[model samples]
Target: MDIEKTFALLNETEPLKISTSREITVAVMGAGSRGNEYPEYGKLFPGTLRVVAVSDILKSRREAMAEKWSIPADRVFGDYREMLEAGRGGKLADILLIALPDDLHYEPAMEAMRQGYDILLEKPMAQSEKECRDLARRQRETGVMVAVGHVLRYSPYFRALKKAIDSGLVGELVNIQHQEPVMYAHMAHSFVRGNWHDGKATTPMIVAKSCHDLDILKWLAGRRCVRVSAEGGIALFRADKAPAGAPERCTDGCPHEKDCPYSAIDIYERKRWFLYVFDLKRDCPAEEILERLRTTDYGRCAYRMDNDQPDHIVVTLLFEGGVTASFSLDAFTPWGGRRTRVMGTEGYIEGDGKTFTLHRFRTGEAREWSYAPPEGGNYRDSGHAGGDLALIRDFLRAVDTRDFSLLSSSIEASVESHVMGFACERSRLSGTKEDV
Candidate 1:
C-alpha cells in the first residue's frame, strides 16, 4: 500500500468540485429539515440544479420553501399527491426528492417514479422489508434513477475509513464494534415526544435510527449480512418512571422542570436547540418559542408521553465470510455521533465521527486523521461532514449523464441494510436469530 496516498485520502479536505452539463430541476414532497438540505444545493451551485416545485402538509413549511426558492404559487401544493399528479408525465421537474416522514417514503417514491421522474428518497426506504424490496423492484421496472438517503457513505469520515480499509490498512478484516448514541435531548424531542416514539406505529427504532449504521457496516465489510440477533427495550421514558409530581406537560408547571434533564424548558427555552423542528429560527423571540412549546408535543414531559421506542438495543450481525459485528444503540447520552472500531489481522482502526486512529501491527506505528472545517468557513454550511451536499453533487451528475453508478445510495445497494434491520427486530421479538 502507498502509505502517503492512504493518508492523503484520509486527510484530504478539498471541496467536491461538481460541474454538470446543464441545470436539473427538482420537485420536493416535504419541506422539513431534509427537504431544506437537498434543495439548498441548487442555490450553492446555481444552474447546476433548480427547485421548480414543492409540497408540504405544513402550510408554513410550504410557504417558506416557496419564498426561499421563489417557486411560483402554482408550483407549491398542500398535498404531495397534488404535486406528483401535476408532474404526471414528467412535466413538473427532472427529479423528485421525497423527504417526507418515515411512513411516507415507499408509496410517494413509487408514485414519483411512475410519474416518469427520477427520485432521491429519504432513508429506511420503507417501514417493512417487503416495501423496501418493492421499491427496489419498482426502480428497476421504471428504469428511473433512485437515490436513497444513506448520506454517511459520502461523508469525509466514512469515505476515508473505507479507503483506508480498501488500501489494506486493515488487512483481512475480522470483527467490528459500533455504537450509536442518540443524544438525550434529541431522543426526547424526536422519539419520546415526537413522530417516531412508537416503534410499531412507525418504523422500528432499529430501522428508523440505526439503518445508516447498519448500512455503513455492510459497506465497510464489503459483503451482505447473513444473520442477525438483537435485544432491547424502553427503559427510562415510560410513564411509570415519571416524577412524583410531574404534570402531563412540562409547561403545566411540573416541579421537576427546573432540574429534570429531559425538561422541554431546558432544551428549547434555555438552550434553544432543535428549534428547526418547529420551523422557527434560533433568533426567534423567547416568548413565542415558549408559546409554541406550551401547545405542542415538544412541551410535554418526556417520561409522560405515550411513546414506546426502545431506549437501548444491542445487535449481533454475521456477514458473509464469517465476518462478525456487534452494534449497540442507546438513547441516554449527551450527543449523537457514532463510535466504531474495526479489527483485522494486520491492523485496527478507531473512529469517533471527527477523528480516526489507525494502528498497524507490522510497523508498530499509530496514525490519526482528524476533520477540520473548510478554510474561512464553518461545517454548519452542510450536514454530516458535508456528506449531504456531496451526495447532491453526485446525484446531479448521475441525472445529467444517465449513469446510476454515480450514486452510492441507490435502491439496490441500500436495501440490504433494511433487510438486516428487519431481521434484527425479528430477533429481538422472537428471542432467536433471524436469517437475512
Candidate 2:
C-alpha cells in the first residue's frame, strides 16, 4: 500500500459511501460499556448502521441494549454462541461487534468470521500471540474485514501529529518517546481491585493496557517492530504493602480509609461513573453501591488485593529500518493521558494528547497546537478523545465498501503490534531482549 495515498484517503473530505437507502445491520456480542459506545455511532448517521441483535450475560445490560435497539426478544440472547447460531438461519448481521473481555475475544471473532460476518474487534486482538496470529489467518482465509479498536490512530490529535511528521517538518522519523500515565484512582479501580489485576489470568499489562501505545508507536514509525526489551515489576498495590490494621474489604472499618488514596469508598462513592466497571446500572442508589462494594472485588483495598501486574513499566523497542522507540506506563500518576515526543533528523515534536508542539531545526522556533473539543463537550465523555466515533465510522465504510484501506486499524497491521507487546512481556519476565 502507498503510504502517501493512504494518508491522503484518510484526510479526504468526501463523505463515506454506504448503501443509499438501506441500513447496515449490526449484531453486538457484548452489551458492556464499549459495546454500547460503538453502536451509538449509528445514531450519528441514521439509515447507515443499525444494531439489530444483542447478547450479554447480564440481564440488565442485554435487556437495556435490546430495548434501546428495539431488538425482539427472540434475538436477545444470554450467550454469544447462541446468538451466532441463531444468526445462521439467514439472520447473520452484516457486521459483528465483539467487545467482550480480553480472554473472550478469539473464539467469538473466529466464529463470527466463519459465519460470514465482518468484525469491529476491540483492541489487543487477543490474549496471546498464537490467538492474534489465528485471528489474522482466519481473516485472510475467510476474506472478511476486521477493524481492531486501536482508536488512537483515528483521533484528530494523532492524525494531526501524523500529518505534521509526514509533511517533512520533522524529516525522517528516528526515535519516539511515549508514556501512558494511568491515574491513581483509575489504576486502583481497573487494574488493582477490578477485573484485570492478574496478568496470568487475563493478560500482561503491556498487552492489556499499553497495546494502544505500542500500536501508535509502530504506526508512526511506519515499520515493523523487530525487537523489544523491557523491565518492570509490581512496585505497589501488593498484599505486603497493605497498611497495618487494614482489612481485605475497605468497608470493614479499615483505619487507613481516611488517608489512603485507593480507599474503595473514597474512590467509588465519590464518583458515580466508576460503578460502570462493576457492570452496575448507572445512577444506582448509595445502598446498592455499598452492598456491591461489601461483596464484590471492586470494594477490596488496593494493597490487599490479589493483583500482580506492575504498577509501573518501561519498554524499549527497535523497529525495522533502525527506527527506535521507548514507552513507559506509570499507574501512580496524578493526571491521566498520553505524552509523546517524536524526534527526527531535522526537527522534533511533543504532545500531551490534547495539545502538541512542533519545532523545526532550521527555524529554531516552535509552533503549538491545542485540541479544543466542541462546545458543551468533555473530551473524556467519548472514549479515547472521540477516536471511538471516528473508528466506527471508518469501520462502517470499510464494511460497506469491502476496502481494507478504509480501516485505520486493520487486523493485518494490528497483529504486528500485538506481537511486539508479547515480545516485550517475554523480555520483561526473562530479562533478555526478544525479537518480535
Candidate 3:
C-alpha cells in the first residue's frame, strides 16, 4: 500500500480537511465499549482530539452509535478495513481505537500500523499467542504507539495500592488470593449461552474476562508469572440438563419459561433485557430481540445451551521471586464487583469487590476504601467503564509525543498476559501446572 496515498485518502474524508495542526483525529475500529473513547480521556482531550469515524460489522450498531455520537453518516463503515482505507485516503484519523470482538483485534491493528495510525487495543490483544507475538514484533519494528486495554492500571484504587506497596505499607509482598466470579447469570448469558459461545470465538474464559486479574497480579507482584496450575470444568449449564419439555428454541411452549431462573426469556428478554433492548434500542427493537431470544439457540434455556467452557475455575500462579497467587472464578455468584486478598509478609489486603482493606503490620491498623469509580468515569455510562476514553487519551499522547513506550500495557505486557492465559487453559485441560 502507498502509505502516503493511504494517509491522504483518510485525511480527505475529514470534515475539516483544509487545516491541520496538532489536533489528533481518531477512528474507532469497532463500536464496542472501546470505541467510545470520549468518556475515559475526554477531560484531557479538550480541543485537541476528535472522533472522526467508526466501523462495525453490524450496520445497525454502527449507525446507532454514529447517530448517538453525532458522527457524520459518511464516516460510518460496516467494514473496518474500508474505514481504514478511507483514513489512508486523506488522514481521516491519527489513531485507531480497536474495540472489536476478541478475535478481531490483530488484522485491523496491523493494517492501521501499516498506514501509520497509532493504536489503542482492547485486552487479550489477539486470539492466539502467535498473533500476539506478531503484533508485538510489528510494533517494535515500526515504533508505532500501541496501548492495550488495561484500564485498572490507571484507576485510583490500584494506583494507591501500588504506591503503598512501593512505600512498604504492605511490607514485603507475599502471596495473593483473589476470586473473580464470572457470575452464573453473566457466564450463562454472555460466555456460555451468549454471544461468545465458542472458545474459538473468544479463546478461553480466563482470557475473555479474567485477563484483567492476570494483569493486576503481574502489576502488583512486579514480577512475571513463571508457571500456572489450574483446574476448571463445566460444572453447570449443559445440554443434558434441558427441561423435559423445553424446546430447542424457547419460543415454542417451553414449560420453564415462567419460573426457571436460567430461562432464556428471563435472562435475555425480560430481566436482563435492558442491555440489548435499551442500549441498542435504536438499531435492535426490544420486541425483535425478544422474539429472536425465543427462537434461536441463543434463546435456548441457559442450562440447555451447547456450552463448553468451564463454569468454575481455580488457578494457582507461581510468579518469579516466589510470589504465589491463587484465583477462582465461580459462575453462580450474584451480580457484584470482585474480591481480592493480597497477603504480604508485613501485612494483608482484603477486597470484597465493593471495598478494599489494607492492614500494615508496622501499625497493626487497616485502611479501607470503596472501589466505586467516580460517577461519570464508568464505561457503562459511555459504554465500558470509560476505558475507551482513557485508552484513547493515552494513544493520542503517544502519537503526539512519538513515544511508543507510553503504553500502559505495552504489546509485550499484553502478550505476557496472553501467555499466562494460555498457561491457565493448559493447566485446566491437563490437570497439571504449565510454565508460562
Candidate 4:
C-alpha cells in the first residue's frame, strides 16, 4: 500500500554484474508507437534486453521492426499466434511485449502466457471485466508474471507526490481531485476521427483514455474502490455539430479549412508525427499526405465522423476507509497533462504533472518542487514524461530477476483499476452509483 516503498524496492535492486551477462529476449506483438517505444529500452540499458521477434498485421511495420532489431526473417510473423507458437519451443523469446489495441489485448496476452512467456501488456488490460479476470486467472494458473503498462506509477512527479504523502508531509489523505485535460487537437486526432472513435465498437472513453487516472487514484488512496458514480456524454464531435456545407472529409473542399480548428489537413500537416496513427508511410511528400488523408478515416471531418466518446466526463469514487476522490477528463483544453490536488488532515498537495506545491496548516507557507530532466537525458523524448523509460527499466529488471514484487503495476494489482474504469462507464450509462 505504501507506493514509495514499493518503488524503492524496485529501484534498489542490484545491477547486473559483469560476469553474469544475461539479456532477456522479447517478442513484440504490435509494432506501432507503443511497440517501438518499449524496445528503445534496450538502447538505454545496453546488452540487457533484446527484441527477438515481432508480429503485426502490417507487413511494413513488422518487417521494419525485425530489421531494426536484427531479428531473423523466419522469426517475424503476421500473426501473433504464429509468433507464440514459435516461442513455445523455447527458441524465440523469453518475454512478450503486447502493445496491441484495447480489444486485442486479451487474446495475445493469454496465448503468450500459455506459451511460457512473461508479459508486458498495455493498459485497459481488456475491453470487458470478464476478460480482465480471465487474464489475471491465467497469470495465476501459469505462475507467469504479467506487468501492465500503468506508466504514471513510474513517473518522477507522481513518485515524489506519493513519497511526500507517505512521509506524513500530508498528515492523512482524505480526498483527492484530479483532472486529465486531453488537448483539443489530440482529442480530434485520436478520439474523433481516429481508430478509437466509437465507444461501442472498441471501448468507452474512460476505459480507453483515462484508465491511468483510475489506477493513480487507487494507488494514491492505497485502498480498494468501493463505489463509483459518473456523469458524461458525447457533447460535441457529432454529425449535428458539423459546419454547414462541410464535406465528410476535411480534404474534400470544406470551406472552413482555413478556419476550422479540427481540420485534418491543418492538424495532420502541422504535426506530421501524428501520421503514425494512420499506420501509413511516414515523412512523405505533402501531396502524398494529403492524398492519404482524403481517403482514410484520419481525414474525416471531426464532427461528421462516427465517434461516440465523450468530450467531457467526471467520475466520483468512494474508497475503503472513508476516503474519497473525484476525477475529470476533458477534451477541450489547450494543453495535455494531468493536474491533481490531494487534501489531507494537516495540509494539501497540488501538482500539474511537471511541478508540485505543498501547503502545510502549521507553517502557513507553501513548498514547491519542479521536475528537470537530467543533463543530456532523453526523458521528454522517451515519452510520458520519462515514465515510459522508467517502466521498461523496472520491467526488464523484474524479468531478469524473476521477481514479481519488483513491478508496481503487475496484472493482479492493475486489474482493480480497470474494474474501476468499467464501473464508471456503467454508472454513466445507468445514471446511478455502481459498486466496484
Candidate 5:
C-alpha cells in the first residue's frame, strides 16, 4: 500500500489543528500501562496524536489513567465496543490506538478499519496467524491509513546497526545469534504465571512476545526464512518449584515470604513490583493489589497456578540464500533485555542489548556504539529503544502523503515474520524442522 496516500488522507481530513497547543483530542481505545504509557512516544506529537478518550475493560484502570492524564470522565468508557460504535458514528475518535490484550486486537481493529479511521495497532497484529492474515487482507482491500507498532524498525539504535551491517562494515552476512532473555520475573508476571497465563487465554509466547524478533530478524537478513526448528518446554516456574512450607495461595497462611525468590507477595505486592509494572505516574496501592489477589486468578500462588507455557525456548532459522540464524529466549534470566551477534564472511557484529560492537576484516579493528535511552526507559520503551516516536512520525507522514517507502514493514514484510514464527511454533511442537 502507498503510505503517502494514507498520510495525505489523514492530514487532509484531520489537518492537525493543534487546538490546545499541547494536545490532540484523540480517543485512545486502550492505553493503560501497556500501550498508552509508551515513553518513547512523546505524550502528544507536539500538537497532534492526543488522547481525548480512553477505553478499557477495567473501569478503575481506565478511570485512574483518565484522571492521571486529565482525560474528561465522560470521555472514558469501560467498553471498547462502545468506543468503536461511537467512532463509527463519528462521535468516538480521530485516530484509534489498539493497545488492548493480544487476543482482543481483532474486533476493535476490524471495527476501526470499517469506520475508515487511521490506526496504530500494537504488534503480533492479532492472536492467531489467520487473524493476522485477515487483517493484512483487510488493510489491502480498504486502503485505510494504518501502521503496525513494530518499534524496532523505528529504533535509532537498531536502525544504525542495520545501517552499519548494510554499509559493509560487517561484510556478507554469515550467521546471527540473537538471545532475547524473556526474564523469569517478566515471564512469570506477564505470561506463565500472570494475566496472560495460557496460549488460549493470551497467545503463544513466540508470537505474543517474540514477533518483534521475528520481524527484525527478517528485516536484518533481507531474506525470507525457509525453515525453522524449535525446542522448548515449561522448564521453570512450575509446581515442582514450590518452596518448602509454602502455602498453595498467597492469601493462605504460610512461611517463605522472606526467602522465596518467587513469592507472590514479594513479586507483586511489594514496591519492587512496580519495576515490572513500569508505572511512574502512579504507585499501585498495596491494599488494592491485595484485594485483587484475594479475588482474581492473577493473585494465585505462582507454583500452584494452572500455568502451562514454556519458560524457555530456542529457535533456529535458515533464511533463503543459506543464511543461518539462531534465537534463544531464556525466561529465567536474572537481568532483562536482548543480546545479539551477527557473523558475516568479512566481519562480525555483537550487541549486548544496548551497545553494538562491529568488527571488519578490511580494517582489522572493532568499534562500538552505545545508545543509552532516557531514564524510566521501561514504561516508555518503544521503537526498539526509543524508536517508536520516529516510527509514528514516519507512518503519519506516509499516510498523509501516499508514499509507500515511508513504511519499514509493509504488509508483505510483516506477514513474512508472522509466517516464519508460525512455522517455528509448528516445528517446536512437531520436533522437526518445518518449512516457513
Candidate 6:
C-alpha cells in the first residue's frame, strides 16, 4: 500500500464503507474511565457494537463493566494478562479497547493483534517512538485495523474546520497557532498528584496528554512535520510553591485549604468534578470524601508532589508545506478549550472550541460555524465534545466493513504525530531543535 498516497487522499471526501448488520463484540482492558466510556458506544449505536468482556485489576471496575454490559461472569478477568491468555489461541472478541495506562498499551495490544483482534488503542498509543512504529508495522503485517484514540479529529467542530481548509475556503495554509488549556483542577488532579505525576514512571506528560493536541495540529497541517523545537518545565506546581501552612495532604487540617485554588476538597468534594478517578460516589458524604482523599493520591498537596510535568509548554513545528505552527499546553488557565487561528494566503480562520469563523480574503464574506450539543441530548455524558462517540462510530464501521480508510486517525496517521511529540520532548530537554 502507498501510505503517502493514502494520507494525501485524507483531505478529499471520504468514500463509502461496507455495512454490517450484526453487532461487533468488544472486550475492554483496564476498565478505567476511558474503558468504561467506550462501551457507551453500544448505547449510542444499538446493535452496532457490544461489550462482551472486560479486564481490570480493580474488582469494582471489572464488576461494573460486567454488570453494565450483561457480560457473563466468566468473561470478567481480574487481569488483562488473563484476558490476553484467553485470546491467544483464538479471537475472544472482534475488537479490543486497550485503554490501559501509558506503560501497558504495547504488550497487551501486540498480544491481542497476534491473536487476530482489531483494536481501538487509546491515544499516546505506545510509550516511545519505536513502540508506535511497531504497532503500525504489526497492523500492516496482520492486515487488521488499529485506530488510535485521536478523538479530536472526529469532532464536528474540528471536522468542519478540516473540511473548510480542504475546500480551499482557507487557501494555501502558512501559519497556525493552537492552545490547549489544561485547567487548574485538571492539571493538579491528573498531573501534579495523580498517576501521571512522575514523567519517568509512566511517560512524559507531553506524550501523555498533549499528544492529542499534536495529532490535531498534524491533521490540520495536512503534511509531515519536518522540524520541531520546544521549551517547558515544571513552573508553578513545585515544592517551593507550597504555602507555609499547606500540609502534605489537603485534609490534614491545612489552614490555607480554603484559599488555595487547587485544594483537593474544593475541587473534588465541593465542585464535584473529576470524581470518576476515585472510587467514591458523587453523593458520598463530605466526610467520607475527605477521608478517601487522605489515602488516595488526590489528597497530596499539588505543590509538594514529585511531579515532572510542566505547568506550561510551547512547541514549534515546521510542516512540509512551510506551514509553521506553534502549540501551547497551558495549565494555568481558568477555562479549558482549544483556541486556534489558521492563516492562509487567501483566507483565515479562528475558533474558540465551540464556534469557528472562516474569513475569505478574496470574498468579503465571513462565515461562522458553531456546535452546541443540546443540554439534555443523549451525548451529555459523552466526552471530547462528542469526539469520543464519533471516533467509536468510525472505528466500528472501519472494522466491520474491513475498510481502513473509513477512519480518520488510523495508526498510520497517528504515528506521525507521536513522532513529533517525542521529538518535541527531546528538544525541550536538550535545549535544541530536533528533526521529526
Best model per TM-score: 1
Q: TM-score per candidate, in order?
A: 0.96, 0.93, 0.85, 0.93, 0.85, 0.93
Which has the higher TM-score value, candidate number 2 or candidate number 3? Answer: 2
Q: Which candidate tops lDDT?
A: 1
Report the C-alpha lDDT of model 2 over 319-374, residue by residue, as the tens digit: 99999999999998998989999999988999999778878788786877655454
Summarize candidate 6's per-residue lDDT along 214-293 as a digit string, tens digits: 88988888888999999999888988878897889988898998899999989999998777787777898788777778
Per-residue lDDT over 1-436 for candidate 4, one digit per residue giving the tens place of the 0 to 100 score: 3434533432231222221148888889989989999788786666878898899989989988988889988989997778777776773677789998777889888887887888899987999989999999999999988999999988777877777777777789999999999999999988988768888777899999999999999998989999999999888898887889999888889999999988889887766748776665567678878887878888988988878899999999999999999999999998988999999998898999977888888877687766555443546434786678778878887887888888999998888999999999999989989999
Candidate 4 scores a C-alpha RMSD against the true structure in Å of 3.5
| Candidate 5 positional error at 431, Å | 1.2
CA-lDDT, candidates in order: 0.87, 0.84, 0.70, 0.84, 0.70, 0.84
Cα lDDT of model 5 by residue, 1-436, tens digit: 2323322232121111112333334567676654564422436434545567789877767886687668877778888887876676674654577888777888788778888766778776777778788888887777776777787776756775676666656668888899888766677778856657787677777877788898888888888888889999887667787777667677676576676666666777773464334332236567767665677665567777788777788999999999999998888888876788989887888986667877767767676666543333331244356555656666556655667677886665777787777787788888988987
Model 3: per-residue Cα lDDT over 1-436, one tens digit each: 2323322232121111112247777777777654654423543434567666889887777886777657897898998778877866664677778888887888888877777777778877888888989999998888777888887665445554555555555668888887887666677778877657677777788888888888888887889999999888887677676668777766667887787776666766666543552244534555877666765566766766666778888899999989899988888888645677888887787876434676767667666654444433333233233333444555566677777665677878888988898889888888887988
Kindly give the number of clashing pairs for every candidate.
Answer: 0, 0, 28, 0, 15, 0
RMSD of each: 1.8, 3.6, 9.4, 3.5, 6.8, 4.8
What TM-score, to 2 decimals, does candidate 4 have?
A: 0.93
Query: Which run of 10 residues does model 6 get worst, by summed lDDT?
Result: 10-19
Over the stretch 345-398, how does candidate 1's per-residue lDDT look in tens digits? 999999998789999899988999877654533442368867888788889899
If both were scored by lDDT, which would come out higher, candidate 2 or candidate 5? 2
- Candidate 1: residue 38 Cα off by (Å): 1.0
